[model samples]
Target chain A: MSIFFSLFAGLGLFFIGIRLVSNNLRQVIGRRLRQLIARAVTGAGSLALFGLLAGAVMQSVNAVIHVLVSLVTAGAMDRKRAFPIIRWANIGTSLLVLVAAIDLHALALCLVGLTGIAYYQQIDQSTRWRHAVGALLGLGLLFLGTDFIKSGAALLRTEPWLRLHISELGLWLLPSFAIGAAVAWVAQSSTTVVVITMSLAAGGLISWNGGTMLVMGAGLGSAVSAWNLAGRLQGSARQLVLFQVLLRLQGLLLTFIFYACNRWLLDDPFNRLLDHFQLGLPARFAAFYMVVQLLSDLGSRTLEKPSLRWLEAWAAPSLQENLSKPHFVHDEALDEAETALLLADKEQQRLLACLPAYLDALRQDAPAALASADKRQAAESQVLQLCEQFLVELADRQRSRDVLERSMVLRDRNRLLGSLQESLAELHQSTRAVMSDPTVAQLLDHLVQSLHIVLETLAETAALAQPDAEELELLRSLTHDRSDLMDSIRRRLQGSDLEPGLRQAVFSATTVFERCVWLARRYVLLLDGPAASPDHPK
Target chain B: MSFEHDINDEQGTRLVSLKGRIDSATASAFEQATQDLFATPNARALLDFSAVDYISSAGLRVVLMAAKRAKQAQGRLLLCGMRQHVREVFEISGFLQIIDSVADRSEGLRQLNA
Candidate 1:
């Protein structure tokens, strides 16, 4: 009973430590980590190094993949750039399993002592070092947990009842592998399972061959966990998860082949090679885990292209994702400042064309909106942001004053477009909210129709190569101030016998409409150029 | 809802009278009814909305599209005989300022003829 208690306590401490370290360390690194990921993709090599670094810090490839998925979704890092990093992170996660091979009882004591003092001295409450302190405490707990697990396994090995069962279990390779896979799936971390297996092997509770099967099974189990974790993810995010799963399967297959050769034909060359290092059973198992990860990484590299194609077919990007990506701006265009600016303008024009789709849900005559307003809005915002980044890059590279001035104007217009999209989305929601009210149905219908016309006109005018002065004047008139009309609607609502929620909806809808009109006018003035609008400040 | 329309040409002006509800279900026919009003260059037309009790956003969209086509063709379009509810729809949308309208058919015809 005491032995079972010790094992359970050790596992509890280990999981708690992992959770503490992963969650807080990310907070400690924060935006600098994200900035590094966004800006440092010079090539595959740098991406792999960063991926390895991320895996080592987080100690779980699953956690690292989650971070990469978010970055990909946000357009901060391309999925193609993230692929190599994910492959290498699998190897990097072996760092913890390797570290666990060596006994660190003294080091664990020192860490516990130091962090205890820090906690007593209130250092953990210091904002600057709080996460760092927590991470150190987690490291100490992790080491202590390792010590407890090793001692518990050593005690359990002396039991004749356990010895009889384990020896019988080790004789059947499939059972050993099945046990490891089941435990790993439950733990959601193969490293945890492998480390526990190492303790059992060192204590003479399991054979080296059994440990090898367990390690391979743990890899497969972790892959399953990743797939389950990514159940809600879509597009390239799902592709990354599939990539990770394939990488694990590839490693498992290679390791099984090597195991078969060693067991049947080759006079145990695999174990013989590990025997050359003079490592104990625990270190040997750790070495075996590392070799499997390395084999997976190497196998994945040779098959990377075809594997990516397969993943793409399996999880093709959704329409929203394709829409969100910038179609015109590319990094190669940045070398030629004028071309880059032109491409940015073209992308902005595309975004403008998408604006009227926000009201498609409210339009009875139109086909169903391509996506929900929020999703479409987010997609447009993503493209607008990319265009802004391209323009900023152009400005930085060009020393010519004329180029810089034009870039600045484009940036201003990009901001106005963002504001316009936001207002239109809000108006859509508010109008929808009141559309069912019998008293205000006609009013809501009119608002939707009027806004739709202005949006379509604005989009059309902006698409022209050089919008004539007459067309520009027409846009200006169409988007001119309608504050009086909105105010009259509000006053009528205030005096009407309507429910408070419906009344507020009407007021909110009118206010957003007014803002949408103002934003459209500002955009038109920007389109007309600063010289043409003396009354509006640049 | 149900909608019906009648189109007549008086001299150079085209007059259309609409009845029933102009909504999503009937907006297509409403649009089809006025398609030929601007077939000729600089055409003049009047739409009477007294018999129409309700106009939904879809119906308004068809009306807005017709007005834009008329402007593009360099033609004149006038709306008249709008019931109280229909006129409120126009006024609230700010379309009253962009498209010309009047209280009754006689005024709309006089304006178009003059």
Candidate 2:
């Protein structure tokens, strides 16, 4: 009972230590880590290497995945580029397992001792080193937990009941494999499960063959955990999760094949290779774990293109995801300020073109192919955010006065576009709210129709490479201040026998419409260039 | 409400007279009624909206589409005889700035001839 208690406590401590290390390390690295990941698009080899380093430093592939998912969601990194990094990160996690195979009692105590000293001196309170201290403490706890589990497992080796149960379970590989998988699925970490199996095998409580099966089971279990975690995710985010699952299955298959070869035709070639190194049971199991991850990585790479196509087809991108991604702007363009500004300008034009889609639901004759207004609005907001980030990044880089001035103009237009989208969205909502009222139905119809027309016109004007003066003048006339017109409508509604709620709805709709027109006019003026923009001076 | 159109040629101009409500149900027929005018390059037409009592956004879209088609074909489209409510729709939409309009048919013909 005491031995079981020690093992349970050690497992709990191990889980907590891994969580603390991953969370604090992420905080310590902060935005710089994300920036590095975002810019690591040079090649697959470099990205894979970076993933390996990230996995080793973070000590958990799950943490690395969370980071990748956010970067992909923010449009900072491409999902295709992230695939290799995810696969390589799996192999990188083996570093901890390998380190655990060796005795680290002294190092673990030293880490804990230093952390205690830091806490006693209030050094852990310092902002600069706080996360670092937390990470070190987590590492110390991790090592201490492993030592406790190992010692507890060794003690359990002498228990008659435990020895009999293990001996019976080891006879049939299925039970051992099932137990390992169940524990790993519950724990949400395959490495943790495999480490426990390694400790058991080293204590002579489980045979080497049973330990290998358990390790393979752990890999499969973690993949299942990943699938559940990604149940709510869609599009490319879901694709990453599928990739993780496929890689784990591949690893499991490869390990099974090797096990079969050794058991049948090959006459234990794998065990012979390990025997040549004279490694202990724990070290051999660690080697087995590394090999499984390596095989998974290598196999997945071989099938990368086909796998990506399948994943994409299975988890097709949503309209919102498609809209959120910037089609014209590339981070690489930031190096050349002029090119960066030009690309951003093109992206902004695309955004302008998307404005009319917000009224799709209100359009009686709207094309069936158009996405819902809600999806369009959400996508537009995301695209706007990405554009803003790109412009900010461009501004930070070294650039000449001319390029800087152009970037500033684009930034100002970007802000106006954001405001225009918000107003239109509000207008759409307000218009929908008043559509059912008999007194305002006709007016609402007219408002929706007219706004749609103006938005379509603005989109057309934006698409032009160099809009003629007539087009500019037309936009100006269309978007001119309509406060008086809105006011007149309000006065007329106020005098009529209408509910106050309906009247307020009309008022809100018209005000938003007026704001939309004004913002559209300002956006067009900016498009005309700073010199021609009277309302927005350079 | 039901809508109908009558088309005829007067010298070099196509004269189309539209009647009744031009809402969603009738906007498509209205568009189909004037498609031939834009099919011919540089075609000139005068659309008389005097008989049309009401026009919705869909109706406005058809009119806007005609105007764009006319411009693309390097032709001219002139609107006249629009009722007060009908004219307000175009005014609020800013279509008046781009599409040529007159108060009556005779003025539309005179402008087209000019």
Candidate 3:
């Protein structure tokens, strides 16, 4: 019972340690990490490598990928890039096995002391160093961890009905593996299992055959633990992890076959080379086990892509669209209204891109382009249709309190986009009406030129993930000019001696321009999101 | 803009019609519309969207600021005939959630005011 309690304590500590490290790191650098990774990761292969490297660096790619997945689902990244980045993340993920397998068989006390001291101090470096040291200390604990495991095995050996069957190396390996895998899975730490296996073997408490089997079991058991944790999260994530495990399991099966064929292959010629050496049984066992782990880790990630692709094909539709950063964010999900809002926004923006081209075609009277304009029109039709669908769904939802408010915002935004077709028609009519008046016509033409520049900037703004400061300032300036024009038009309307018809007409034209400006600002606000926008462009 | 809504014995039925621009200068019109409904016996009103063409922050304010007014009156306001320009103004400002909207006066008058 005491032993079981100690084992539980050890496992509890392991979970707490990983959680502490991951949480603090996230607090210190969570939001920026996504931006950084997005900026850094480009090519698919490299992105995958980045994912792996990030996981290795953070000691938890699971956490980083969670952030990435959230951003991606929020319509943040190019789909093509997201796919590749996710694929390569596995490359770095495989390295954890290597981290767990390393023999940190010394300096456990110093690690704990340093970590304690670092945590006590409030300096920034100390805190950062504390996490790093805690990880190292955790790595160092693996050393004493092995000692504890050996002690456990020693205690087990003394028990009266202890079951230690002596059989061929491969035969005994399966049972050893079964025990090891179960231990690692339950403990949620392959490191603990590996060290425990090593300690017992080194202490002469378990045979090399048993030790080797535990190592093999550790490989299989890891997926069990990972899949278990994966199931707790969302998206196609659990499915993706399961798919990844299938690939790893295939490697395990292959390794198991090699274990069976070991005697045949490593017989006399292999025996003679080792026979001359005075290597300890424990040392030889550790070396052989390490070799197996490295090969499996490297080979599984690299070679299993094709198989994973096949698995992914089966797995794609199986993934849930939870839109969460599964590993990090637990409950941060957009409600149906929000989901609809974002989807509608994206679809609307996509539709908006067609406006310039269509307007240009109409201006040039390009009949051929009218066919393409029809495509744009169809796109707009799709946007409006989607908006209605989203609105209908939004209407039906019983959202949470704050999100309810956000829902209103989304609904409003959708309706705002809905006004486009008719508003554009009015603008076109107003332009034609005002253009007929000789005095304002040239000014209107010039203003349209300027408006086009402003709109070009707006379009450029539309194209940009983030607009440049100078361009943003220019946009503000254009809006300011538009507002000024509004003021001037009002001033002109107020002048008493003017023709009543022209006065009304001028007033009407100003209103149309003002409306256009207003809508443009609204859509622009949508693009900038709810972030604080600078008042007016330069 | 000043707004008015009136709904009948359909319980949640009412109609609100407007008469001015909706901005800082004329935001009171919008407020008066909701306030006038609140002063009435009806618990529901359809907002006559035909007259209201422009909306600004101040206009949106009256809609949001008087949220408790309709509920206190045991009534609600449903917006109707929200021309695209007006609807876009509401949307960009995020007014869709606070007030119920319909295609026309009849629909607003019939839809649930609550």
**Candidate chain B TM-scores, in order:** 0.96, 0.96, 0.72
**Which residue segments of model 2 deviate by more than 4 Å?**
A1-35, A101-164, A368-374, A395-399, A530-538, B1-4, B9-13, B19-45, B50-62, B65-88, B96-114
Model 3 chain A: lowest-lDDT 10 consecutive positions: A323-332
C-alpha-based local distance difference test score of model 3 = 0.52
Residue A472, candidate 3: Cα error in Å is 20
The candidate 2 chain A region of ten consecutive residues with least summed lDDT is A529-538
Native contacts retained, all candidates in order: 0.26, 0.55, 0.00
Q: All predictions: root-mean-square deviation over Cα?
A: 5.5, 5.7, 21.0
- TM-score for model 2? 0.81
Judged by whole-model lDDT over C-alpha atoms, candidate 2 comes out at 0.79
What docking class should model 1 receive? acceptable
Using all chains and alpha carbons, the TM-scores for the candidates as numbered come to 0.79, 0.81, 0.42
- lDDT of candidate 1 at residue A500, scale 0 to 100: 89
Which prediction has the highest DockQ against the true structure?
Answer: 2
Give one digit per residue, the lDDT tens place, for model 2 in A133-215: 99889878876776666667557567888677876666778988887787667555677777777777767778887888889
Best by TM-score: 2
Can you tell me the DockQ of model 1? Answer: 0.34
Instruction: Put down candidate 3 lDDT per residue, A480-505, tens digits, no spaces.
Output: 42565467657855865756776665
Task: Residues A16-63, candidate 1: write the lDDT tens digits.
Answer: 665666556555554345456667875767887898777765556776
lDDT of each: 0.78, 0.79, 0.52
State, as a TM-score between 0 and 1, how close model 1 is to the true structure: 0.79
Interface RMSD of 2: 2.6
